[model samples]
Target: MTDENTTVPARPRGGLLRYVVAATLARTADGGAVVAIVLLVTASGDPGWLAGALGACITAPHLLGPFVARSLDTTRDGRRVIALASVVHGATLAAAVLLYPSTHAIVPAALLIASGLLGPLLTGGISSRLPAIAGPSRTSQRRAQGWDVATYGVGGTVGPTIVAAVSAWASPHTSALVLTLGTFIAAGFVMLLPYSPPASDARDVPRPARTLVVMFSSGPLRRTLYLTMIVAFSVAALPIAAVASTDQLGTDDAAAGVLTAAYGLGNLAGSIGVMARPLEGNADQLMTRLATLVATTLLAVALAPSFSLATAAYAAAGIANGYFFAATLAARNEYAPSEIRGQVFVWTGALKITAGSTGTALTGAIVGTAVHLPLVLAIALTTAAALTSASERRFVTRQVRAADHVQPGTVRRD
Candidate 1:
């Protein structure tokens, strides 16, 4: 059944541009916090463990994503919820900046965790609103998703650059303050968004656990989630492999930096390409192809004889990474039920973050043992993702064909 509240009016001439700007700012705030925190911790002469602790604090709130999204789902006006979250997020960041000089760890930790709780407003919340802004056209939605992915790439690249540049000229505290101000600006942008409230339906809302169960029970969504996690793990391992490649080449750490930048450039290029011309094929199939490309490139990087070769391979992998991200978002929109779509997006984001964090820690532990181990492991994971996608496709196709063959009046029991 179509939900009237969810249906966007015919495309307004400049509606999409407004949403793009809002989403970009939101992503910038998200990425800026990460860069600002790292600089802040480093400049304070804190132990490495403090930095790690801060990272955990930032990511820990994501564990509550489903619950948060559930609450949002209960409300008709998601935009208001998102706007409020953004304000709270900005306020907490501002508080963290003001309290940075305190000797106690608890104050900063608590503030950071409070800010992190609003991360979904910037990420999945914005994404969930895309369909509304893009109207009912599939092409428009695809373009919007592509732009969304590109904004993420841009934010990740620009946020660190801004923090690093400011920190170089001034103090890390100054950079943190700047980022805190930026968060407020982002909140302003979010509040300006024109999304209508999702239409309330008569269907019963499932409990969070039941919603999760229904989501995972769907073949396509399950495969997509698995693919997202595997790809995230591989992407996280890239930095570990980049460091190892520098060691293998007996080169300066600058080589690793260059390699990392190469990947980012490729990711940006791929995202732009998708924005210009969206992928053509089944979402699952496109995802499978992209995962295969990532796996193959990682394998090549592992075997690369020179730093140059490794850099090229990593960049290639990153291009595939960008496309894969877009495909997965599209898949989520395609496969998830409307009632729980927000939860699904938030859940997916949390899982990807968790997988990436876990992969980074694992890679750190093992990369010292073998220069190529991280890349090899990444390749294995991507390969498994591809296989899983292929299996899902076959299973779904069988189910469709079987249903087609069944008599009209008779129900077939599985």
Candidate 2:
């Protein structure tokens, strides 16, 4: 008879690294898509309004991403989801290249939204498969997550540079074509990866009751998620602010693009920093401070009288945002149970996307009309962050207690 008191260790499956690499390549496709749309509209000299409209349209699918990602929870075949989503994303990019301008703005806008919808599905589906890939070691799982973030950062930095060079050397249309081809390449890579569903696949899973419960089980996690949402929204807001600042500075869009690039640079730096020295000892307290720092910097950007000051402030915001994101995610991986991790992560992405899209839309509406757009946004973020900070310490302590009960060896193995 099998030993009743002992849990058997599962096999350490191979090809996880392949999946990671493929996922990174797929992410590069997303970055190229962003660049293709931005350059195409800007090159046309159709004014900033069209650019912003396109962005909002592209991101609209995120509003439905949570609902879409739920399918992964009910299904055991995560690999199929990832594979099909990749193909769809590739096809959508191809369609965008062939049809965006010729088919009218609305048609392309809808296509972009459909492409955006694939992201959350891919994210949720892959995360659900991690347990199979990482086996039983919690540390191994965390390491995998860290590596994934690193890959994403590297791809994000490289994609725009390539797009800029290609657009300059050829044209926006050529860049779009390149993006379409890149997506197809990425899809091919993903198809070659192995499939590994979690051992929990045999067990019955519950439907998600609510978004809040999905993301906010641990107090610290909830607080961190809120901070992250704000930061992401601020990211969406940065381009708007950059454009305004460039106009104020009597410079070209290149200046604004520089500031935007600086923000992404800061994000990469922050992600690297977090991975190098993981959040330890009072993680929630540290994140609270970082959130406060981000809020204060946003406020500073709002009040800045000069273009250089605003640019610096935006960079600072990006750094704080990245640090908070990485550290908080590390903490969540430690806190959330493996079975529900995908659900939580799915909602987290949903919140980030929703907040980001809303931020862009709100800022787009307000920046030109409002006297001090940055100041207003700053105040909003500061107030939300301050409330979160005050609650963080208590939240962390409570979560620690909860984790003590739920951690491996404390509860019966599933």
**RMSD (Å) of each candidate, 1 decimal:** 3.4, 6.6
Off by over 4 Å in 2: 1-20, 38-57, 100-110, 122-146, 154-157, 188-195, 199-203, 208-212, 216-221, 246-254, 282-286, 299-313, 369-372, 379-383, 392-414
> Which pairs clash (backbone N, Cα, C closer than 3 Å) in model 2?
none
Segments in model 1 whose C-alpha atoms lie over 4 Å from true places: 1-8, 406-414
Looking at model 1, residue 321 earns an lDDT score of 90
lDDT of 1 at 21: 77
Encode model 2's per-residue lDDT on 1-414: one tens digit a residue. 123344765554555676667666666766667777878888878678887777665556655666666556555665666777877876776687678577778887777888888866555445545545644444454445555566556666666777788899998878767766665666665656555554355355545556457456667667767776777676677778788777666678788887777777777766666656544545566667776777777777676677777677777877777776655565555555555656666667667768877788788888888646754775678567757667766666688998876887665566
Clashing pairs in 1: none
lDDT accuracy of residue 47 in candidate 1: 85
Q: Judging by lDDT against the true structure, name the best candidate.
A: 1
**lDDT per residue, candidate 1, 217-318, as tens digits?**
988788788899998988898887887778777788778998888899889878888889987767878889989988988887788788888888878877
